[model samples]
Target: MSRAAIVVAAVACAACSGRMPVLDPGGPQAARIATYWWIVFWLSALILAAVVAFLLHTLAHRRVAAAPASLVEDTRVERRLALGVAAAVGLTALTLVVLLVTSVATGRALRSFGGTDPLTLEVTGYQWWWDVEYWDPVPSQRVRTANEIHIPVGRPVLVKTRSLDVIHSFWVPGLHGKKDNIPGHGSSLVLQADRAGTFIGRCAEFCGVQHAHMQLLVIADQPEVFDAWLQAQRRSAVVPTDAFARHGFDLFMTGPCALCHTVLGTPAGGRRGPDLTHLASRRTLAAGTLPNTVGHLAGWIIDPQAQKPGAQMPGNAFGADDLSALLAFLGGLS
Candidate 1:
């Protein structure tokens, strides 16, 4: 590809999920994986270099040495060649053993998490979105949100995942390895961030057309900050007070928007799509396909297919006034 096209692609990817540096881990689990990766990489590089050097040395020796007279069969030379072959075989076996042991150790370390106060999340993978449910012991205290997930820094997060439609894998290279979300089976991933920052996650498995657009954000925050955010999410959506917003709420409840999306503490509860209880609170919309802004949201509502092909949400043809009121109400969902 041309340099300009490569630059454009890089910019688009950055806009979608920033830089995904698998080697630059942000957590203990990812660090272990990265360590294993470097071990294998160096071992392979060394093996390649050794093989190339041996080939060059053999070629040079053949050119410099005279031809054997009458094919003299020397037992000493044959024994030396056999010993060298055996030594090379032994080294290869040792390398294989090292790789096997490290693989097992990394896998075990990733699965070894049983903290007393680890936060649990039920993350369901959809066709092109993520359904995140903060699993609380008390059912009423549970909070539901979409793509944006916040976890307390320096605490383990146990994520139980399953797929609602086709198989999808949840992967945040900055935190952990890929864990597939099978339809009939459930899997769990334990991740912990050592510092406060945002990490990008994506559906690692190929599910459908919009798989490329299926992205999520992992926000690591201080314990107190995460607690406050969770508490805020647990509350219901604020009832609009102004005239236009109230009218927009009425329109939302009485229109097609109520059929797929849910707004907590209201009659407009629908399960097919992402919950809009804290819609404006999220950083992105449609599983990170578009930024969560007024103009982008308006454009998505008017024509979702244009933004993301094969999206489940259909386009609408609302009048300009209705569209403004709808935006006014939805924009204040925070």
Candidate 2:
């Protein structure tokens, strides 16, 4: 259809809709945008109403045909109009001040509240994945993991953000907001959950070719469950006793893979990419694009460029056996 027709159709559809549009008068972050819009809407409506009222009064009392030679402006009417204009401007300014103060207060509260002792996760964003490290100070331990970040519900969780390559973003809509991960410059996000659930987050900023693929997951749970998960993540690297996985482990260690990737208890300590200390424990590979399974892992290992074009990971020469062995070893890293 033509542009004019599309515009007319959209307007007609909107006119026929019955639901009240959300007027976000005040909230936080993007939610506060609606509040600003609502203020504009009401201010415009009031101004239009005043203009229409004045025009109607002028049309009723003022002479249309030019017959009177000594028509004079009324001082009282002029003063009333000036007062109305002043009031409108003052009210608009006051509204803006209130909105700004409220937003500042909300942000301060979100930053300061300490609901309970919470888990701390250090999440580093890479070109195509997220490297997650669970740090518990009380237990005096650290657990290296991948894309999925776990926390305890009803607690204030602090997340530290860093980037290995370019800048990326960490965002979880259901819980809080987005924070950028920049190289050399470290940022932090303090978030909390009201209840227990799995909240999905992603790299909100555009970092590179596979920027869209950089996803992260946050699992909020009870304290006990979170502790158990910590223990599981801290377990020694999975050594595949099976023939294929064993061969894959050997191939991974002896091949060029060790130069860029790191498996905590193994020889593959290539720090160029995300430290895959607990690779298999992660939900997705390729920075949260694909699941951490044999198929996706194998495919990514074989041809990372095909899976994520412009990925920093260079796909080198490898046969089926070599690829299979590498996949097995990486997959068993947890």
Candidate 3:
């Protein structure tokens, strides 16, 4: 391929990657932000054009015979120039005031949480993953999940955020602005999706060696679908009925795997790691580090540190048959 063809292919690949979320607004908050951005962008462009035109005009008239010595001291011309400068300054001030007011109004709109009934989600940022819990007034209604969040379309969601170890940021650029999750403190933000789609989220603040891997998915679904998903999440993990799966389950519960992770409705209730009750239901493993497939799951279980250098979970040593059984059991949790 020619150099130009290669360059075009590279650009096409980057465009297909869907990485520029800020430019593609998916919610009301992000739409408002995009509007503000465009306003400033156009205003800046106009000012730059004006400056460039003035410079070009000056260059074109550079040989106009340095203002006649007599006209250089003309009080009337000086007065006119002074008036022109004053007018320009006043106009600039007015523009600034307008921009300021627009910014303040947009900020207020973004911060407003005025829904009579909003879904509440408690998000706690861990070193390399997000611990997410769907909150409810009834204790039993609360559902615990990790890495992925589901919300109903056209409804407001109040997200309460905090950090367990260090400062982290919750940011879904297509949905809203970044909110800090500070340790020893609490912060909250409101997000609402205008349509049904899947959006990606990431930890904007640096936390540790695997900070870049701290990613999540925000799924906006129809009301019925979202409710059904919530109901499923609130239930315990499905019990395996196959003989191999049962054997794997026994090994998981009796071995070191149960020491850090929890499988709801089972004897394992460890809280130091992400919940495994709905592990197979998630799209990614190790917090978006790998696709949630049987091969990836087995690899992660055998050697987690190789995938994430600073991950908290340690690798487990299991024979080939035992590893296959364990993967089968975990994959059936959905």
Candidate 4:
């Protein structure tokens, strides 16, 4: 379709979802799965049609009930019917075996993308958030972020996942299948994106009251773009410029926020919450539940429990001046 046509269609459906992830594949794994689904769907449809036609033919051609069973029975016809039934059963079993083998092969292929330079990341599932840690050979170069992941297109990624509390599945249907993060046991998945775009991921398993709000974004970018992003994320946060921001930083370091959150280059090194070093760069707050705007950020920090009933973050009773300063500091993080 032409770009204009596509744009028109998008505008027409602006109120609806933009894409169906299962059908709109951005990776080889998702493409293969969608192919498998269509194959089975069409084959089953054909089989149902065939069965219905046969039943209709049988019903249309009726036999009179004038003779006894022994008198009217034909040995050749009975043998043929038996043979047809046996053949149908054998064919059904064979089809099932083929499908099973194909599915297994596809699964194995999806998991076999390991390479020498594969990007390795650790994703930990919280009650209503995802903590993502990008691993590097140099410990100092490692990065810890939340809810957003950026990867290079066409490069393999090794994602190790674990849950802090309960089972939560990590899935971006447009890129790959679901991988469960068990509470006691860890799991890993190999995934790659063939296209450069953003995909949404959600916790497939229910963990708590905020399960539905638990979401993440996977952004696939060009290699150069990804490298640039990595370099930016690796650096420490910039120093606050204005007085309000500077004062807010001091308040954060002295208050309870310092114990549960970390801001690189500063003394606030708490690991219990998401890193706030480059918090302003992110597009969403509370695991994609709220837009990353000054207003939404203020609401989230002032009363997290009011927005998310089971949120782990407690409401901070900051005075009007303190709140303004804090918001200024956070907003200037980018």
RMSD values, in order shown: 2.9, 7.0, 4.2, 6.8
Indicate which candidate wins on lDDT: 1
Superposition-based RMSD of candidate 2 using all C-alpha atoms, in angstroms: 7.0
The 10-residue segment with the lowest total lDDT in model 3: 11-20
lDDT of 2 by residue, 1-334 (tens): 9999998986566323122223411113324434444665776687688779988998889966776565797789789999989997997788678667766766776676544665677888877778777776654368766678888766677788998788888877666667888899998877776667766677778776566666777777788898788787776676678988898778777877778777766777787777777776677777566677889887787788898788888877788877766776676666
TM-score, model 3 to reference: 0.90
Candidate ranking under TM-score, highest first, comes to: 1, 3, 4, 2
Clashes of each: 0, 5, 0, 0
* Winner on TM-score (1 vs 2): 1
Give one digit per residue, the lDDT tens place, for model 3 in 1-334: 9999998986555223326478688889889988998889988898899889989998988875674766457788789999979987997998799799989999999888449898999999999899998988898788888999999999999999999899999999899989999999999999999999989988999887787788889999999999898888888887788999998999999999898888988998988999899898899998888899999998899999998888999889999999999988998878
Ranked candidates, highest lDDT first: 1, 3, 4, 2
Clashing pairs in 1: none
Which 10-residue span in candidate 2 carries the lowest summed lDDT? 18-27
lDDT of 4 by residue, 1-334 (tens): 9999999996665323324367788888888878888778877898899899989998999888775657777889899999999999997998798789878878787767677788999999998999999999899999889999999999988899999888999988888888999889999987789989999888888788888778899999999999999898999977687888998888888988889999999999998889888898898999988889999998998999988889889889999899899889888777
How much is the lDDT of residue 105 in candidate 1?
96
Which predicted model would earn the best TM-score?
1
The true-versus-predicted C-alpha distance at residue 105 of model 4, in Å, is 1.6
Q: What RMSD value applies to candidate 4?
A: 6.8
lDDT of each: 0.92, 0.72, 0.89, 0.87
